[model samples]
Target: MKNLALFDLDHTLLPIDSDYEWGQFLVRIGAVDPVEFKRSNDAFFAQYQAGTLDPVEYLEFALGTLARFPRPQLDAMHAQFMREVIEPALLPQARKLLQDHLDAGDLVCIITATNRFVTAPIAKALGVEHLIAAVPEEDEHGNLTGKLLGSPTSGPGKVTHTHAWLEQIGTPLDGFGRSHFYSDSHNDIPLLSVVTHPVATNPNAALSAHATSLGWPLLQLFND
Candidate 1:
């Protein structure tokens, strides 16, 4: 009877939204037009918070830059992005929480709406082996297509992808003695409802109210 631990990356383990920050990072580095990119990025982030985000449209916007740059340069840029943007957000409390799950030998996975291109390195940095993210397609030339390869791991798709991933790994959601999901948005409610322990972590107003009504546990990883 193994325990399963699932985490949402943005606003759950991290106090900030990594996807939106990555967009701002590109803007800061002059890789993209500051005015235009920021405008679209902020809009999509707002839609995400509202739980009305269309994952496909968001990915088209987010991954468009990936197609314009060569892999080597993209890799280097991401390296800088990690150091300048992500490193500071990897707070002690979040690290300790991840460590606790690892030390307990729980089957840990990060299930996020963020794309694989942006999140893979972050997952590696966090020492997480399993990630379910919106996967971008690569061409025969090994170039990004700026399109999703499968269903976006978001909203209802979170439950679908998690179940599919678990099936592939030979462990269904109910197979574990206990399953835990930590998330911050109402967008994740579908998956949260299915898990044995659903933690409203750094929850937004909607999720806070929902969790409170349901008597779910609330955790603030970034509480000062």
Candidate 2:
């Protein structure tokens, strides 16, 4: 039987939150007003940390920037963002963790609440072929619609999306003899609870306590 390794992006593989950093990147590039965008961005990030984030509202705020610009411009900006922000945030330990899974012949994948547009490239950078993330809707003209194509892969929704992805690939979760999921937030509990091995990677206070209680392995990928 095959082994499966799933990873959460923000704070797990990377040191910073990709969605929040993406907003700051847009502000730095003057694509959005710093004061206004920062206020909303900080609030959304706070809610996410507290595990009270309203996915619809946050998606509207995050994806609205894509809706305002053409794909070419957004693509260029995302490329720069990846080079300047995301690349530097990639921790050596995180890469090693992914490599360990690969070496073990596990099917590795990234499951994140961040939209596909932002995370797809990040996944490619990490050499992960499979990604399960929030899907951003596009209009008939190939422009963002500032809406989600489906339910956001967050909190309990992560489990739902994972199941859907497995079914789409003609495999069920039970097919894996040993399934591992690494995450940093308590929001991933639903998926974590289902996995055979739930490792807490650089977990927050809440997640740390929860993982401790469950005797899950705690890993700190970024010390710098």
Candidate 3:
């Protein structure tokens, strides 16, 4: 049987929330009104941390940036984002964690609630081949529609998406002798509960408490 290692992209691996950083990136580039965008962005992130975020509303705010610019322009900005913002957050410990799983012949993948447009490059930069994220819809003209194409890969949705992805690849979760999931949010509890190994990396208050109760391993990849 194969071994599978799954990682959450945001606080778990990167030490910061990618979706919130993407919003800040747009504001820094003058793509949106700083005052209004920051306010909304902070609010959305707060709700996310509280485990009460409405996925649709958060996507409306985050994916809306893609619709405002052409694909080429957005791509270029994302490249800059990778260099300036995300690169610094990719700690050596996180790389080692991923490498350890790979060395053990485990298939590694990132599962994030963030939209694909924002996380795809980040995953590539981190040398991850597979990524499961919210799909941002595109229009007939190949432009972003500022909408989600399917269910958001968050909370219980992560479990659903993981099963669907496995089915598409002609492998069932049971085919894996061991399955590990590293995450930082309480929202990830549903998926974590079902995995063979559930690691809480830099967990939030709720997740920290839950992990303690469950006796799950706690990790801090960002410590300098």
TM-scores for all candidates? 0.97, 0.97, 0.97
Predicted candidate 2 versus true structure: per-residue lDDT over 1-224, tens digit per residue: 88999999999999999989999999999999899999999999999988899988898788887788998888999999999999999878889999999999999999999999999999999999999999999878777888888888999999999999999988799899999999999999999999999999999999999999999999988864
Q: Judged by lDDT relative to the true structure, which candidate is superior, 2 or 3?
A: 2
Clashes of 2: 0
* Cα displacement (Å) at residue 195, model 2: 0.4
Query: Which residue pairs clash in candidate 2?
Result: none
Candidate 3 per-residue lDDT, tens place, 86-157, comes to 999988899999999988989899999999999999999899999999999998777798888989899999
Against the unseen true structure, what C-alpha lDDT does each candidate score?
Answer: 0.91, 0.92, 0.91
Instruction: Say which candidate scores most in lDDT.
Output: 2
Off by over 4 Å in 1: none
lDDT of 1: 0.91
Q: Per-residue alpha-carbon lDDT of model 1 for 1-224, expressed as tens digits?
A: 89999999998888889899999999999999899989999999989888888988888888787888877788899999999989998888998999999999899999999999889998899999999999988888777877678777899999999999999999999999999999999999999999999999999999999999999999988985
By TM-score, how accurate is candidate 1? 0.97
